[model samples]
Target: MAVQSWTDMLKASKKTALIHDGKRKIHYLFKDGKEMAEEYDLETDELIVRKWRQKSTLGGQGQWQVEVGEQLASPVASSGSDVIKENCSNPVLTRKDTKTSFQWRIRNLPYPKDVFGVLVEASERCIVIKTSNKKYYKKFSIPDLDRSQLPLDCSAVSFTHANNTLIVSYKKPKEILTLEQELLQELKKLKGTAEGDIDCKTQ
Candidate 1:
């Protein structure tokens, strides 16, 4: 005869169906829908087994009965209305409105008693200025600017030295293209010239 342990009997009692002979009750333990063991339960008949039932509340909440030995366990208490304070919530990122302004100025140079020997190279796209000392010459280029950005009238742009500073003055124009747009247009022209040169070499 095979002997079953107390732990085995208790585990089997969880899903066991009770078979009553009117004299003694038999609880059959099943694993995977196959009977594994049988245990005699004298108190299973005396103890109350609550049938599982579903209940609903006025708040539209549903509660289910737990299958305990004696009585049904109480439903968990609901936490009253969710109150979320804005300050306590996660921070939201916001993009601030910003204005970007650009200005260009030429500062004075050192050493020269006066601004002389200055050579100006002007083109439709830009102006190149070269100044020379006894030993070396320094070259600077000022790009063509939009007419709208000028100081108005803008008959002529002038560069001079005054108060130990190089000053540039121009008449502002009413409308002008952005510096970036002009640069891109220049780059496209350069690219086209480069491609033409390559095609000539390949030919």
Candidate 2:
């Protein structure tokens, strides 16, 4: 899928059938090295959650992990109507969005900065974090970029360790920023159903 728009992006899936549990529209995509599942609110068609997993170096499939749909609200906070907020109260991880980049903070790492490494796996189009001692490992995607159909750039990824926390940041691409503005403008014209009008919908 070229992902020309938000609808195009949502429609690019390999699953044969679309499924919904009355509250959300669910879709699945399975590719060479990764698989993803997405959920969207039925009334608003807004992404509710996404989970994905990738092939492991050890030759077995890795466990499915969240790719930022539920925990992180829409990243397109271009309109005054949308202001992305972080749950700093989360004990494990918290995300902070800045003007130029997206950042994720993982707490209680207790390791030196050198022990942690953050990298972008282009094949999976996601970020992977690993420790030298093999104690901590995580794989997660940037939903903002994914929704915008943007490519992952290894150079944009960087990390630092301080105060027993590991903070990773990815520089935002210019294309994504522009697309967000356009999407926000387009979304303003559409009226969504109210909370009481929810219904089941297909992907």
Candidate 3:
């Protein structure tokens, strides 16, 4: 009997999945930063297995959008073997039942090569971009939270650039407190005036 290596053993035990009009033999083993898998095709020499990160909602329970390169693959299935991949980073994670909003400026930035990263709030989903330009502002309606938790009732947001860093401020009190405890401490550090109440800088 011939001696079999671990690689050979994994290749022999990989799970099979149909994709891109061909059957792919996927081994649930990790090697060389790539999952163990083999693609058998009659037309091409061999299919290359590429691994990349994907974004998901509900703590990765949601659907995944695979990132390929400059181009993204659609999730829609066409042929039996074709796999649809999407290109974009997943949104930041937050606690459930909490609404949050982010504000940023697109001015002077390069045209977005990937629009999947831009999320729409009202839609509570990601959208595709047709064109790229400066002065482009967008708002996203994220899941796991209500609109009331957002700042200014989901009104206009602002971003301040200072010392090569962007500072985002929210008009809501609870929202600001949720971001940092030090901020709340700073707010508490303010002193009251004798005549009336006055806002003071804690930091």
Better of 2 and 3 by lDDT: 2
List runs of model 3 lying over 4 Å from the truth: 1-81, 87-109, 112-139, 142-156, 159-172, 175-203
RMSD of each: 41.6, 12.7, 24.6
Per-candidate local distance difference test:
0.33, 0.67, 0.33
Model 2 Cα lDDT, one tens digit per residue, 88-140: 54436666555467788888788789998899999998899999999899888
What TM-score would each prediction reach against the true structure? Answer: 0.23, 0.50, 0.22
Residues 124-178 of candidate 1: C-alpha lDDT, one tens digit per residue: 3333333455532344332223222233232344555544444444432323334
Clashes of 1: 9
After the best TM-score superposition of candidate 2, give how far the Cα of residue 203 lies from its true spot, in angstroms: 22
| Stretch of 10 with least lDDT, candidate 3 | 90-99
lDDT score, candidate 3? 0.33
Best by the TM-score measure: 2
Q: Lowest-lDDT window of 10 residues in candidate 1?
A: 93-102
* Candidate 3, number of clashes: 10
Clashing pairs in 2: none
